[model samples]
Target: MNIQTVGVIGAGVMGIGVAQNLAQTDHQVILIDISEDILDKAKYEIRNNIRLQSFFQKSDNRKTPDSILEKIDFSTSYKLLENADFVVENVTEKWDIKKGIYPQLDAICPQHCVFAANTSAIPITRLASLTKRPDQVLGIHFMNPVPMKPMVEMIRGYHTSETTIEIAKQMLSQMGKECVIVNDSPGFVSNRVLMLTINEAVFLLQDQVATAEDVDKIFKGCFGHKMGPLETADLIGLDTILFSIEVLYENFNDSKYRPCPLLKKMVDAGLYGRKNGQGFFVYQ
Candidate 1:
C-alpha cells in the first residue's frame, strides 16, 4: 500500500483528469492510450488545467507545470505498467471493451497491483469476475473534473477485501480525496439515482414539455441544484447516459430505466456534449 507509482488506462476526459490528479500530487504516473494523438491532447489539457488552477486558486502543494508534467509517462503500450503499484482503468463503458482490458490487465500488472475501474454504471462485481484478482478489483468512480472533485464513489465488489478498501482510501488520501464507500449494485448509488433524473429530463424534452433552457432553469432556480438534469446529461455525454441506462434496464429488467428516445437520437447524430460542443445545448 505504499503506492509510489500509478498507471492510468485510456486518455479520454476521465483518464486524463485522473492522471493529472495523480501527477499534481507528485506521484509517478504512467498513462497508457492506444493513440499518440489523443495522448498528446490529454497532456496539453492537463497542462492547461494546471496553469488555470495556479492562477485561480491557492494550495499548499502547488506544482509547477514542468514539475507536474515530469511525473507523468505517456505511453502507447501496456508493458510500461508492469511496475505500477496501482492501476486505474477509465476506458469506454462498453462491456466488450472492458472484457477485453480486464483480462489483459490481469495478465500484465504485477500480482499485488489493485485495479480500480472508473466506471459510471457497470457493476464492480461483474468487472471483478473478469479478472483473476477479484479481491483486488474495485470501483473508484472519480467525477468529471478529477482534480477538483473531493469525493469519489468507492465501490466494493462481492469479493473485494477490507484490506483493498483501506489501500484505496490511502491512495485517495494522497490525492486529497475522500471515498464514499458503497456496496456494489447495478448502477451503484450515484448513477442509479442521477441517471434516472437525467433520463426523465430527456423525456421532458422528447414530449416537448419545455425548452431545454426552461427545464434547466427550473431545476437550478426552483430546486436550488447546481446543474439541471439535461445539462448534467450533456456533461456526462448522451452516449454514456444511454449506455448506463441500458445497463440499468437490462440488469433490473424494469421499464423505469428505459432511455428516452431523444437521448439515443442525440448520440446517433454524434452530439456528445462538451467534448464535441453539442448535446442538450451547444458548448460554445
Candidate 2:
C-alpha cells in the first residue's frame, strides 16, 4: 500500500509526536482524540517541538513549524479516519481502552487500510482478533518521543500477512525510521526486557539499596547506557510503567515482573513523571 495520509489515534505524548513526525515528512495526518482539551494541548506541544527542532537541525529544511502545524487535521471524531491510508493507534495501554477502540477503527477505516497498535506489552494477536481484518492488524511499537527514535519495534500478529509487514516497513521508511520485525508474544522484546530492568530499579529504590540518581548513575557510568532504567520509566510515565509491569506479571504469572510498591504509590499520588512533573525524581 502507498500511504499518503496517516491517521493517529489518541492525543497523548506518543500520538502527538507520531503525528508531528508524519506531518514533518509531508504526510497529511488525521489526529483524533476523545477530548478537545487533550487535542488542543497536543497541538500546542507539536508546534513547540517543531520550533525547538528547527534550531537544532538547521540543515534539514523539510518543514517549518507552520508547515508541520498545517499538515495535521485535528479532530474529535473517529469517522474522520475514513480517508486515511494507514492508522496508528497510540491509546493508553489498558486492555479495556484498547478493546473499545479497535472495533470502532475497524468500522470506520477502509477495508484496505492497515491498523497499527502502538502498545508496548499487549499482544498484537489479541488486538487482531477484535477486528474483521485480522491480517491487516499489527503492532508498530514506537518508542517514547517518536520523532527522536529512529528505530521502531514492528510486531507481526499470528495472522499478520507478509504484505502487511512489507507495507508497514515501507510506511516507516518514508518517515525515516527503521523497523526491527519480531514475532508476536507478550511484550514482544523491548518492553519485556526494559520493563523488568525498570521494575528492578524500583526495587532497589524501595529497599533503600541506592538512591534513584545513584542507581541510574551506575548504569550510565559503568554500562554506558544513555538513560537509567528508573529515569526511562519516569520519561515513559510511572503509570504507564506500572501498567506494563502488571501486564507482564499477568501474562507470565511470575513474581519477577511484579510492580514496585513505590511506583504504585507515586502513581496513586498523581505523580507521573515528566508529564505531571513528578516521579522518582521531580521534573521542573
Candidate 3:
C-alpha cells in the first residue's frame, strides 16, 4: 500500500492543493481534469499558493517557483490515471458525479490502487458502495489552502478495509501532515463542530449584533481565534460554507445546522468570497 504516484481528478482549489502538496513531496502527480483551460488555471492557482507559502515560511529559500512547477503532470486523458498508486476525486460535491467515476476508475486502475475522495461532507460509505472495489475507497479530506493547513481527516467507510486506511494515514503523515482518523460520520469532525459555531456567528450578524469587523475583532481578541467565522467564510467562499451546512442539516435534520439566510442571499447574489472579490466583507 505504499503510494508512489497520485492521480488527482479535478482542477479546482481542493484538487490543485492536493496535487501541489504531493508534488512538493517529489511524488509524481497526474492532475486530470475536463479541459486544458481548467488545468492551466489550476496550475496557476497552485503556483500562487506556493509563492505565498514561500514568503510566509521564509525558511526554504532554495525552492523557487520554477522548481515547484516541475512536479505536476497535467492531463486531460484518463489513461494517465491508470498507473496511479492512489486516485483522489476532488470534483464538485455531487453524488451522481462521484458515483460515475468509481466504476470507471476501478476498471482501469491497478487492483491494489487505493481510491479516495476529497469530499468535505459526503459520507465515504456511500461513495464506496458505488465502486466495484469498495474496500479500496475511503475519505482523505484536506482543508482548503492545503499547504498551510497541517490537518487532514482520514475517514473510514464501512467497506473500506483497515489496510487501506492505515496506508492512507501513513502517506499523509509522511508528507509532514497530521492525520486524525474518524469513523464515517456526517461532516466528520471538524466540519460538524465548525459549522455550528459559524452558524451562530451568522445568526448574530443577521440580528445586527455588530458589524463584520467588530465581530471578528471581538472573537479574535477575546477567544484567541486567529480568524473569526465570518472572516473565514469570506476566505473559503460563502457558497462552499453554505453547501457544507446544507449537508449537515439534511443528514442530522437539525435546525441548528440550517444555514443563515444572509449566507444564502450572498451566495445567490454571486458573492462567493475571495475568488469573487466579495462576500461578508469586500475583498480588494
User: Between the candidate structures 1 and 3, which one is better when assessed by lDDT?
Assistant: 1
Candidate 3 collision pairs: none
- Which order, best to worst by lDDT? 2, 1, 3
User: What TM-score, to 2 decimals, does candidate 1 have?
Assistant: 0.97
Order the candidates by TM-score, highest first.
2, 1, 3
Q: Which run of 10 residues does model 3 get worst, by summed lDDT? A: 60-69
Candidate 2 lDDT by residue in tens digits, 76-138: 998888877899999998998999999998998888999999998999999999999999999
Best by TM-score: 2
> Would you give me the overall lDDT of model 2?
0.91
Residue-level error in angstroms, candidate 3, position 39 = 1.1
How does model 2 score by TM-score?
Answer: 0.98
| Model 1 residue pairs with clashes | none
Q: Which ranges in model 3 have alpha carbons more than 4 Å from their true place?
A: none
